[model samples]
Target: MKNKMTSHYAAKLLTASLLLLANYAFASDIVFICHKGNALNAKEIRTAYTAYFDEPKIVDNKALRPKLLQYLNMSEHQYKKMWEKQYFRRALTPPVVKKDDREVVDYVESHDAGVGYVAEVPHGADVEVCGK
Candidate 1:
C-alpha cells in the first residue's frame, strides 16, 4: 500500500512538472529563422509558413511546435488539418519535422530556401532571423 501510494504521488508530481514545463515553453519567445540571405520578414514568414510555399520548412518539435503554431495563428489540430488537406488534395508535402533547434538550424543552413522557428538560435550558426 505504501509503495503504491508513493508511485501515485510520484506520477502526480511528474505530470505537474510536465504541465509546468509545457506552459513555460508556450510562454517563451520564438524566432523565425531562414537561410542566411533569405529576405523573409515577419509578415512574409507568416504567409510563407501558413501557405504552401515551395521553400523547405523545418519544425522543431520539442519546445517550439506549439509556440510556432500560435505565432502562425493556429492550433495544433488546425495545423494538422491544414497539412492533411494539402497532402491529400494537392499532394503537397508538409514541413520536415526536426527533433530540436539544433537540427532545425542545421537544415536551414544547408538549404538555401529553408525556413524554421526555434526557441533560441544557437550561437555561430549561419542562419538569418526573419522575425521574433
Candidate 2:
C-alpha cells in the first residue's frame, strides 16, 4: 500500500510538472509592433516601452512599444506620461491592430513587417523577440 501511494504521488507530480511546462509553452507572447511602413528597429522598441533612453537606435526595421494599454484602461497619452517620468520622449505610433495580445501575435506572425508584444516564447522564423 505504501509503494502504491508513493507511485501515485510520483505520477501526480509528473503530471503537474508536465502541465506547468505546457502552460509555459502555450502562454501568449508579446512583441514590439509598428506600421509595416515604419523604418523602426529593436532599440527603438526598448526605448519606447521601457523609457530608459532618449533616442534608441533602430535595427532591422522594428519598433518597441508596451503591450499593456488595454489592460491599463488608458490611452497612448496616459501611457506616454507614465513613461515620460522615466524619460522617453518619442512620439508613439498607434498599434497596428486593435485587438488584444493574441491577435497581435497572429498579426505579427502573418505580416512580415508587423511587430507587436507577445507572451509566447518565440520560435524564431516567425516573430522577433525584442528587449530579451
Candidate 3:
C-alpha cells in the first residue's frame, strides 16, 4: 500500500510539472527597454512606437513585432499602413528592425535615446526596462 501511494504521488507530481512547463512555454512577456537613464511610461512608449515621438529612436525585434502590434490593438497590416502614411505625410522614420534580443540590446546601448522591446528583459547594465 505504501509503495502504491508513493507511485501515485510521483505520477501526480510529474503531471503538475508538465502543466507548469506548458504554461510557461506559451506565456512570454515583452519588456520595453530603453537606454539607461531614459525612462518612459506606457503612453510614451506607444507614441514612440507609432513614430509620434522622434526624440527616442525606436527599435523593434522582428519576432515580437506581432505581439507589439496586438498590444497596440492593431494588426500587422494596419500598423504598416499607418507607418507608410505617416512617412508620406510627415516624413517620419520607421522603427529600426533588429533580428533578436542581442541586437536590440546592442543598439539601445549604443544610442542614448534608443528604445525597444524584447521578449525577455536583458540582464545587461546598459539598458533600463521602462515598461512591460
Per-model TM against the reference: 0.71, 0.36, 0.75
lDDT of 1 by residue, 1-132 (tens): 999999999999999999988866674568788898875876677766665765656455565787877666688889889888877876767888888889898989998888888878899989998854
Candidate 3, which segments miss by more than 4 Å at Cα? 1-28
User: Could you tell me the lDDT of residue 6 within candidate 2?
Assistant: 100
Candidate 3 overall Cα lDDT vs. reference? 0.83
Give residue 48's lDDT in candidate 3 (0 to 100).
82
Against the correct fold, how does model 1 do in TM-score?
0.71
Worst 10 residues of 1 by lDDT: 54-63
- Judging by lDDT against the true structure, name the best candidate: 3
Q: After superposition, how far is residue 132 of candidate 2 from its true place, in Å?
A: 7.1
Separately for all candidates shown, the number of backbone clashes (residues 3 or more apart, or on different chains) is 0, 17, 0
- lDDT by residue for model 2 over 78-129, one digit each (tens)? 8657655544345533334434445565665565455456445334434455
For each candidate in the order shown, give its overall lDDT on alpha carbons: 0.78, 0.49, 0.83
Error of 1 at 20 (Å): 18
